[model samples]
Target: MDCGKRHGTKYFTVSSAENFKECMETCAAIVPCHSVDYQARTKKCYLGSHHNNPLIIASSFDSAHSVGCAGACGGGGCCKDARKDDVQEPAPLPDTSCGNAGFEFAFFPNDITYLGPNDGNFNPVVMKRTQPYYKGTTTRIGVTDAHIIYGQTPQNWEFVAVNHRGYLYAHQDGEYSFTAPIADNLSLLWLGPNAYSGYTRANANLEAAYTPVDSAPLEYKATLVKGKYYPIRFSWDNSGGAGYYELKIKAPDGTTIVDGTTTVSPYLVKFGCREAYGARQYAPWGEEN
Candidate 1:
């Protein structure tokens, strides 16, 4: 496609939309966006201002369809979902090693009454009050962890979402499978490149709509190389009811890691720096940082 054929004012672009409909709505929100180009192969939306023109859109591809970005959400409704995505420079995820231990947790409490509606996220209205809920690392992703973060009694972790971000260290190459066996109100997870800057609720995986609770463990698997690191993130929300969540994992060799109170698997770990951990490199074990 002659991306630069039609020249005009080129504004900024973003690749956050994970679905066809989302890609459409994102462009509709921008006043100057003339059209949108979605790549099914990449599962990402590339949309920016053409000022009714174009400038070298992106990489070469087989086929493309020129269409308007008007979709279901309607511009006004999509604009209210500020918690959906934000325009900001992406922060780098630092390197990781076997020496590292535990995950870093952050809390976004969306409980302010005047904040209008509960968009299921900590929007800008309450963004200033965000805090570090937990500092230490835990061996298991047990259901009880919610209470520890909220300082509430058992079976009463409410009005908060626990976000854990770190690297999924693949010590040995194999198919890494993940599943949410059971969850109270809500649970979501993300892995690989999109888990970083382009993350949104639309891109999250492993929910319970397709499978029943504890009946069949529907697993989402990713073939990973040993010694390499993949950006990882999983969130557990319990604003509507008492909370309970268990993220079970299966290593390549079929060794399962379940996040129950009595079990502790040495899988999840945190790297010290907050730089570019998304570079896809092997672990520098026994090597200096």
Candidate 2:
């Protein structure tokens, strides 16, 4: 089940805390607590037994109040009694077979030290020098699809890095444009038969000093072959704030090969760290790059 910040049926106050995670942890510890309301301003936490309580109305519109439901209500029986009156069902997901293609994504938590100020410069030299601390594949499905990966609370600070690798298929041999939304840090590299090098290649390296609002889409032009799988890698770093990123491609045939709504198959390969200079360790895929 998904937990969201919204109004629900009222219940007794179990505890009061300043942190939202602490309140959610408290609710998880309780056997009867199914939901929790955390007020960011006053640091107050309210526990609820029912998932969908129609009685609790929205008192005020403020970011302080955050209500979350536990994942244990997956069976749809946690609050069945409270949802019998005029409940609207969610719309079904659209068919994703329009231009389906698969891609792999690996998430490294707090491992991208190159994104820090200490690194200063972002280049292939810097990228090859950095080593990942904690390496793990993201089990989240539809990672390649057009959707935002919600940010998580970091241990030391708020940050996340993702490495995306996949084979881009081209219908005809021509110029293909690849683009992705600007983030705190974004880097893309494509290696194919027609090799292009230096800073003029079909690649991009956007640094931390650039803001997303004032930035334009990172564009790269490449000539690909038909029905060929090219080796492509995209790395993203989010230091803090919202954790989200997007990638899109415009094919030579004037068709959107990888649109903002495209979904790709993702898998988790392994977990652990790799040495910086020992071998070329590429994120979760190891030395396969």
Q: Which candidate gets the maximum lDDT versus the true structure? A: 1
Which segments of model 1 are wrong by more than 4 Å? Answer: 1-99, 112-129, 133-135, 144-156, 209-213, 262-264, 272-289
Number of the top candidate by TM-score?
1
Query: Between which residue pairs do clashes occur in model 1?
Result: 92-275, 93-275, 93-277, 94-275
Candidate 2 is scored at a TM of: 0.42
Tens-digit lDDT track of model 2 for 1-289: 2222334455667467655566666777777776666555566777777655323222221111223443433454232223344343321221123322344554555444444542333333233334444343332322221124423333433355555554454456688876665444444445442211222123443222323544676666778654344545556555555444555666687766654354432211121111210112233343331
The TM-score between candidate 1 and the true structure equals 0.50
Q: lDDT per residue, candidate 1, 247-281, as tens digits? A: 67677888775354524455565653323233332
**Model 1, global lDDT:** 0.50
* Candidate 2 global Cα RMSD: 20.2
- For each candidate in turn, the TM-score is 0.50, 0.42
Report the C-alpha displacement of residue 4, candidate 1, in angstroms: 40
Worst 10 residues of 1 by lDDT: 56-65
State each model's CA lDDT, in order.
0.50, 0.44
